[model samples]
Target chain A: MIEFKDVNFSVDNKIILENIDLTITTNEFVAIIGPNGAGKSTLIKILLNLIPNYTGQVFIEGKLNSEWLKTERIGYLPQKEEYDTKFPATVMDIALMGIAANKGVFARFNKQDKLKAMETLDKVGIKQFNNAQIGSLSGGEWQRLMLARALLTGSRYLILDEPEASIDKSGVNSFFDLLSELHKQGKTIITISHDLHMLNKYCTFLVCLNKTLHCHTETEMLTADHIKNTFGEALKLIEKDY
Target chain B: MLSYAFLIHALLGALLSGISLAILSPFVTLKKIAYMGEALSHIAFAGIALALLLSLNLSLVTMLFVLAVAGLIGFVSRFFQTEETNVITIFLSVAMALGIILISAKKDYSFDLASYLFGNVLLINKTDIYSLIVLSVVNISFITLLFKELFYMTYNMTVAEVFGIRVKTVYYLFLFLLAINIVVAVKIAGVILVTAQLVLPASIAFQYVRKLKPAIIISILVALVASLIGFYISWQFNLPTGAVIVLVEFMLYLLSLIINKRSKVRN
Candidate 1:
């Protein structure tokens, strides 16, 4: 559904991302893993068009990168939802923000929209917290709420950055279940996760970056080699502990 | 309550400021830009000081000059967003320093430190009412029209950009709304103490509401209550109206903090 060919980007003449080429197929779950400051997040930002003035060719569904706006085809969930946490809003209210996105300032949401929002929240397992203030939700519940917010767009593609970061071990299992359910619904899931063990279960494709680009399929990608190469000496310490 | 003309003026100004501050407060608190917004008010105070020194319409001059300086601060800070605290500190220092300089230079600058510190509701006049009406209409319409873009930008700016939202335009627009709210509030609450009205309501609203509309609506209601109590307390005690209003807001904030603690213990 998306294509990036030879993307090169520099901030203030310092190379941030370089020579990146990859294609994200429809209904595929791909994770790009890397160490801190490894350009993994940069790739996501570039794809989302957060970082402008980049050198590359990005096409979404055969359209030029510059031509597309944030349509209902894609939904984004950021790493940290610190803003909404401190604010007093209910789960239903945030999910409804996706619907409000399409409406004008004066336009009111219809009954159908509210019902759909509730349904989305239910799917994420936060339906019980539908009326509960989002700040009052636990970490796991909040992540699910974020998913519901994304699903409110009814988008086929979900771009989640560090979706499981906030959740704990028990929460991660539930989050995995949530992802599995979303996957079953024939949605395209492109997530950037640090969890390496998920390559066999959820991730069908993989990309690794450390100020450069590397792409491999599940069959060809080796875990230890790629991690060591991308992370440098840090991976050695991790391997020693493991 | 007795005089028709005076009452109308008071109501218009209060409602206009109440709504404007309601919408602007979330942005200030959520983005952690309260410090910057607070400093801009002080900068606005400096402009008012200068206008009074020249015997000009303090309101008009304050609006134009603060907006200009605020825009400059906005532009400069975008390039230096490595640390939010840095931007906050830089703007706060500049604004505070300039305000002190201007105030100290003029021996008879009659911009009462008390009213500006807390806000003088009793000083509400016809001219202030007219300005509030214009500001309220403008702020409400602007926020309504750009709600989606602003929502996206404030929550996840990168996502907003990817979706082709004019982030720079929206960013500057946010600054403008903030500047206007500061001006609207400065007259009623006074410059230094307006932070109570601007941030406390939203922070309290945020603690209870998970949705934007309810949060905003509740914040306005909260502000209205605080404003009324403030006016009443000052009248009863024969004290500065602004300080009373600020104190009312302080109590609300304290109440919220206690509630937060109780909830955390329960969780």
Candidate 2:
């Protein structure tokens, strides 16, 4: 479970998020939707303790985000653009980093860790590329590899940022299907995405955010007025379809 | 040359520094911080001047000074939200100017500028060789203990931090290690050659191998072989050791490029 109370964030005195209060119960498939520059990513960053200077409070699993970070792990899939693609790491090397993150600094990856990594890679449908260099992966394959890394964390909560941004149509479908399966398996998933149709299909709840909390409700209860209010009048077409 | 104690010390110095720098080479190449290495080497010039002026242990004083400068670079870049390269460049110029000014301040210092700039192999002694050994151990242990963390940070620092890797601590430690490396390596390889070694070995390795571990091994081998052969050639021909080693590394890099290209064409 995650909770944010009166969370407000700013940079250079420009308000990015204001008066945002939200709660994400366990096993909920939450989708945060907004237009560009809507502080969706920033909100996630604050929850992850990446942006520590934000106002108000953020709690993860009944503990402060900072305390939670010290004691627990959260699976995170950042935007693809954030990766250094030319880094000379094999797929297996990157997958093992997940285990490395959970272990002590000096602990070596044993046989069990390797097997677990392989299992996670298989689960993501990229086991064949385990020994392949990361630089050789396609966009969709890279997304799958990143998914494998996130899964290998073995965290109850998975936070993904724009997982479908660079993948093809078929890739996005399979990706969402995997998320749906994870959600069904009782993982609390909070994802930032632009694919409203997919979010409507898979997400249990919708949080409309544009510098503030415009709407927070179950997916089926989301109305066109809520979309318009959050995304402004420019997204009227999307609202009409909503 | 083999009979001379100074010559043997120089060879030992080359071998130890080669191994140490090779261990760090891949990280430097992958992170694209060869320029940081370059800037730090030049920054060590001011450190050297300060050491001489204060009548302190040159290596220790220079290492401490360079570490502080590296820390300052990290702090200023983060605080001002400026590009790190911009900060490094600013510090590089200021440090170089300060080096020259400090060296000029001494009326009878008689500093051997050329020896510091290009490195004098004959000046290497037992203490220098011992320092190189310590450097080699530190470099080896650092890479071995924190290899995964370093790899994660280099791959994507933000993602690493998101996963609770303490990226900032590791990054600052890396900077400190790099500062020490520059200060130590400068005694044998000098500024220009140290920068070249930091860049060339991993570059040559990547041309042959695609994975990080093999690339690191190949990088180490290339550095060792270059250092040994460069030492022998310089000893045989009475040439400058640092310049000769850089040339040899450059030649090997070109050879790797050729081999890689040929393999690609055949495929």
Worst 10 residues of 2 chain A by lDDT: A233-242
Q: Model 1, chain A: how large is the TM-score?
A: 0.90
Task: Give the docking tier of candidate 2.
Answer: medium
RMSD of each: 4.6, 2.2
Candidate 1, residue A2: how far the Cα is off, in Å:
2.8
Error of 1 at B152 (Å): 5.5
DockQ of 1: 0.30
Error of 1 at B36 (Å): 3.6
TM-score of each candidate structure, all chains considered together: 0.78, 0.95
For model 1, the superposed segments whose C-alpha errors exceed 4 Å read A9-16, A33-37, A70-73, A104-106, A136-140, A162-186, A194-197, A218-242, B1-27, B79-123, B134-174, B203-218, B252-267
Scored on chain A only, each candidate's TM-score is 0.90, 0.95
How does each model score on lDDT? 0.72, 0.86
